[model samples]
Structure formats: structure tokens, C-alpha cells
Target: MQKEVLIHVRGLQMMDAQGDQEPIEIIVPGQYYFRNGSHYLRYEELLDETAEPTINYIKVSGTGLEVSKKGLVNVHMVFEQGKKNMTYYTTPYGTLQMGISATNLELTESEENLQIKADYALDMNEEHVADCYLAIQVQPRDCKDFVL
Candidate 1:
């Protein structure tokens, strides 16, 4: 069964070369479900101020995780600790060769809530772009005490 959920995402990107940091935070309505052993969170990219909202699917499992989205930014990314995955990022302007190497993946789940933290290195066009950290917190729609 699928349950309605509220998702809060906070991301930080630090450029390895320039040491510039970019931070983004957003809270969106989403759905949470489980299939087999994998947990799935489906949401839309509404706060990006885009003409069309991108549908995002985040699948988490024991081995790794996959994030796929279509619309404003189209990309399918895989993060498995200690392994690098190559992919292409598509935008309205053009496509760029993207690589992601996951350094850490931590997940916690309980009856109360679910939390995930991931750290990785990001590269674009074979050049190091940034070191990234992503944290996601999911809770039932009724839960209001959790803060970003």
C-alpha cells in the first residue's frame, strides 16, 4: 500500500577546486511505498520554478540507491558505496557527461520516520565539480514536529 508522506530534502555542494558551496532546501508532498525489499519515494519538483514539474522517484535498497527524474532535468543516477557510475544529464540546453562516486550511505527507519544521508563526489564532463551531501527525511503527513 502507498501512503502519503511529506519529504524534506537538503543538499549541499562544495566545489573541490574553488571551494564554493551551494545549498538547496525544499519540502514537497510525496508518496511512500515499498515493493519487495526496496523503499520508494515519489515526488514532484515543484519549487524549482520551472514551467513543468519534474517527477522524481527515489528507490532505496540494501545494496545501493537509484534516483531517476524526468522533466526539467533528466537523469538516472546510481549510488553504490566505493563504486563510480557514469551517466548523462540532460537539460534544455544540452546534455553533459556526469559521474558520481558514492562515499557514504546511511539509512535509518523506524515506526516514527525514515531518514537517509548520502555523501558523494560529483563530476561533469570528466571534470570534478563538487563534493555533495544529501539528506532526506520522510514522515507521515500527520507528523509536524520534525524540523528541517
Candidate 2:
């Protein structure tokens, strides 16, 4: 892949108590690079007209993946197969203790694209909130297979 890329992200949150929720999907332009044996993807997300855009960073390593966001909300989350990670999530509304217990983590990469899928359970304030699935696809901006 090239430095300029298109990222397609799909996220599903299935509430343990309430059942399924709508999946969130987004396709955006992003920057991709490799450093220190890790692949990094960076993008900006505009939450609304008034607030500044949020910066998102994803780091993919051999062992796991880490996602960090800064702006209106700040968070640093880690995902590793069979491991539970905890962090404080700060948002405009308030802060909460968040936990991510990843059940599965898969990655597929080729000359043209990179794909990641993660299945995990999410917890907030020590209570089970939901089971989540996240899929991320990254490809060169000029790739012919790119789609919305």
C-alpha cells in the first residue's frame, strides 16, 4: 500500500442485555506508514460542525493492535487475543472505565490491501456492556477495488 490510503471501518456493538444494535460504517481517506516494525494508520473524524475533528491512530504489531483517539474524546485501547485490557475513556459527557477482552484477532495483508477483524467483549465501569466486532480495511487511494 501507499502512504495515501482509503480506510473502510465497520463496527458492530451487540448489547448483552438488549441484543443487537446498528452497525457503524465509515470510509475515509487516511495516511499509512510503517515504523519500528509496526504498521500505523492515521485518520481524522469530524464528529460535528462545532467540534474539532478527532484524530485516530491505529498501530498494528505482530502481537496485537492498539487504537488511540484524541480531540473531543480521548482513549487508548489495546486488543490482543485472549487478553483483557483496561483503560480510562474520556468523553465530552464524562469519563468511564473501559475494558476490552478480545476473543479473536485476525489480520490479512497483501501487496494491495490490509485487513483486520477483531471480536471482543466490552465492559464499562465493571459491568458488561456489549460484545463487539470491528473490521478495518486499508488500501491504496488509487486502488481500483476501492469501494464505498
Candidate 3:
């Protein structure tokens, strides 16, 4: 991938406990960059109506994904296929234990773009929260001034 790129992130969250699944879809655009062996997508989170915007980074790899947020609500979580991870989710109010288990993970890449799709289940403080799906696509941006 190029040094400067465009990132599209789509997330679906199931809201109901019954068989009827109401998914909430969120789409966000951001800047993408790569360093070493990891790909990073930088974006600002403004959905929570917080005072300050939270800087978020979605780190992608061949085996898993790690998402980190800094600002109003801080959290560092990891997701790997067939593996469970436990981490602490920090917020203005307090901190809570977060658990994430991945059901499926797929990654595809080329010289100019990459795509990641993951399905996972989330648990907060040992209680099942939601089953979620995250899709991220990164494509190289054409910029005259930016050098890759």
C-alpha cells in the first residue's frame, strides 16, 4: 500500500437478543498509512457526543487486528481468529474488563489496496455484550504532493 491512502470502515452491531437481528451500521472515512509490517488507519471518533474527539487507530495484520482509542474514551483491544483476548477498556467514568473472541478473520491485499473482514463476539466484565462484524478497506490515494 501507499504511504497516503483512503480508508473506509464499516461496522455492524446486532442490537437484539431475540432471533430478529437489528444491525446498526456505521461508516467512517479516514487516512491510512503503513509502517514496518502493520497497517494503520487513523480516524476521529465523534459518535459519542464527547467534548473532545477521540483519536482512533485500527492496526491490522495477517493474523488479527488491534484497535486503540485515545481521548474521551480510551481502550486497547485485540482480536484474533479462534482466540480470546482480555483487555481493559478505560473511559471517563471508569475502567471495565473487555473480552473479545473472533469467529472469523479474512485478509486480502495487493500493491495498492487491502481489505479485512472479521466477525467477533464481545464481552464486557464477563457478560456477553454483542456479536459484531467489522470490515475495513484501504486504497491508495492519488496525491500530487504526498510521496509514498
Each prediction's TM-score versus the true structure = 0.94, 0.96, 0.80
Model 2 stretches astray by more than 4 angstroms? none
Q: Which residue pairs show backbone clashes in model 3?
A: none
Superior by TM-score: candidate 2 or candidate 3:
2
| lDDT (tens digit, per residue) of candidate 3 on 1-148 | 6666666667776644763454544444577777888788887777477478888888888768999999888888899999999999888789999899999988888887778888999888998878888887777666333221
- Candidate 1 regions with alpha-carbon error over 4 angstroms: 47-50
Residue-level lDDT of model 2, residues 1-148, one tens digit each, is 7999999999999987668686999899999998998889999998778999999999999989999999999999999999999999999999999999999998888887899889999999999899999999999988888743
RMSD of each: 1.6, 1.3, 4.5
The candidate with the higher lDDT, 1 or 3, is: 1
The local distance difference test score of each candidate is 0.89, 0.92, 0.78
Question: What count of clashes does model 3 give?
Answer: 0
What's the lDDT for residue 69 in model 3? 91
Ten-residue region with minimum lDDT total, candidate 3: 139-148
Evaluated at residue 116, the lDDT of candidate 2 is 89
